[model samples]
Target: MSKALTSFLGENLADLKDKGLYNIIDPVEGPNGPIIKIGGRELINLSSNNYLGLATDSRLKEVGKQAIDQYGVGAGAVRTINGTMDVHLKLEETIATFKGTEAAIAYQSGFNCNMAAISAVMDKHDAILSDELNHASIIDGCRLSKAKIIRFNHSDMEDLRKKAKEAKESGLYNKLMVITDGVFSMDGDIAKLPEIVEIAEEFDLITYVDDAHGSGVLGKGAGTVKHFGLSDKVDFQIGTLSKAIGVVGGYVAGKSDLIDWLKVRSRPFLFSTALTPADVVACTRAIELLMESTELHDRLWENGNYLKAGLKALGFDIGVSETPITPCIIGDEKLTQTFSQRLNEEGVYAKSIVFPTVPKGTGRVRNMPTAAHTKDMLDQAISIYEKVGKELGILA
Candidate 1:
């Protein structure tokens, strides 16, 4: 390494430390679930994205083990070369059916899916109207597309309409697309998809919704598109198997042509190795479970509601969240970090989110109550929150 580069990195690292923005990773000692062990202590985990608590489910593990026994552990090569397995096709088919689309394609991760799909269609000649609060994957994908990115205020239909009109009127682009997250992760807010679809229709723009956090949460586990009954109207529905599905991989559900085009053009799909057979099988089984019954989803909602009610009752400022994601807004970054630290010390595993992940001075500790969390667990978390809030002067 160059000495100059090393010096620059050292300076930047020191700056982060000085500002109390440097984070030290805390390792989870066991399986991630509703409750997790960290640093030899078990805590009620409200920081995980495993919405349905499927990450540690024994059923998924059995399916994964069976696939491994049958097909081994790896895909061996990229899909375009020789890696496409029967399980991959089956998973895609399952995703298509779940999203009510003609076809679907899977990628290594949700982030890779966005990076691949957005650039596959939209290019330098195209313009993309994107939500300001879209996931980082979407932002990176838009950048990779080399398109003119027009940002609209988060969930602001009027701003989206204004930007859409401007982009359409300029005639400076060959294609126009609007993209947003189906459910924002930080604030746990649902996107205004119905209004967005109406705007897309008026502007003749292709619509895309990344439902990474929505799948297995909204629409009885079908997703936000299905939740809003706009499955047939949205052009692209992106989802992940990592969170609620308790597996790994990302997929894009859309018309057959779009899937076909992505298979041929998406660099990640063409060059990166496909998902392992076990992952594909486990993901398929997870979807099957979701379709079979709404028990898990309903339980998740109950847990979410319980936690939200408990938090609000404790006099914490829970933001305007319409989903299982509840945020305790603490404002200052240092205080938010301290709050999270105290929660962990008190046997509650809620993580603090500060600037860059969220807006400045709006730092919060996001709580994700999964289906596996019992009422007693939530009650304990609320008690801990109250204690921490009082000690820190956050609550009267």
Candidate 2:
């Protein structure tokens, strides 16, 4: 490597180290469920996004194993060549049916879906109005689109309307699209999809909702668009097969023509290998389970409410959350990191999110309570929280 390039990287690493911002990766020793084992110690896991606990469900595991038995391990080539297997088509169809859309296309990841879907339609002459606090994937996707990006305040429909009007009034772009996360992961706040739909309709802008965190949590397990009863209004409903689905992949559900266009133009879909047969099968079966019953979703909500109520009763500030995602807002990045370390040391594995991931000094430990967590586990976690809070002088 060149000396200058090496020097620049070294300086950046040194800065991070000096600020105590460089975290060492800690690997989980076993399956990721309501509780996980790390360093041979079990902990009440509040850091995962597996809301429905499908990641450890026996049904999904069985289906995945069967797929492996029948189709082997991997897709041998890119989709455009010969990797589009029967399982892949079934997954796409299942996702479209679940989202109530005409068709769907799958990508290797939710991030890839954003990169593929956004750039496939919008270009330099187009404009995109994105939520100010949308997911990083959405931000990167918007950047890749080469579109004139106009950001609206988080959950502010009026701001979205104003921006949409400005973009349309400019009359310089061929197309205008509005994109947002269906559920804000940090604060666990559900997006104002109904009002966003109204603004999109008023301005005749294309609508997209990335429901990665909402797919198995909202709409009795259908998704955010369905939760708001706007399935037909939103042009693109993007979601992940990871998390609640307990597999891996991302999908975009929309009009048949739009999906067809993506199939042809989305670089990731065309150039990347299709999902493994096992992953596709597991995802399809997970969707089937979701459609068959609302037991998991109901249980997840119950656990979420239980944990949130318990935490609040102990005097810890759980930020504005309308959903199961709860955050213990601990200001100061260093303290937040220290807090997470304390939790882990105390046998609770909640991770701290700091600046760049969140705004400066608003660092927090985000908790994702899932259906698999028992009441006893939650109670224990709350007790641990109380001990930690008092120790840190965050509570009485």
C-alpha lDDT of candidate 2 relative to the true structure: 0.91
Could you estimate the TM-score for every candidate?
Answer: 0.99, 0.98
**lDDT string, candidate 2, 1-396, tens digits:** 999999999999998766657766889998998789998999999988888888999988998899999999998888889999998999899999989999999899999999999999999999999999999999999999899999999999888888899889989999999999999999999999999999888889999999999999999999999999999999999999888887889999999999999999999998888899999999999999999999999999999999999999999899999899999998888888888899899988899888778998898888899999999999988988899989998888
Candidate 2 lDDT at 102 equals 98
Q: In angstroms, how far off is 233's CA in candidate 1?
A: 0.8
Best-performing candidate as measured by lDDT: 1
* Poorest stretch of ten by lDDT in candidate 2: 16-25
Q: How many pairs of residues collide in each model?
A: 0, 0
Write the residue-wise lDDT of candidate 1 on 1-396 in tens digits.
Answer: 999999999999998666657677889998999889998999999999899988998999999999999999998999988899999999999999998999999999999999999999999999999999999999999999999999999999999999999999998999999999999999999999999999999999999999999999999999999999999999999988899998788999999999999999999999898899999999999999998999999999999999999899989999999999999999988899999999999999999888778888998999999999999999999999999999999999
Global lDDT of each candidate: 0.94, 0.91
Error (Å) of candidate 2 at residue 239 is 0.3
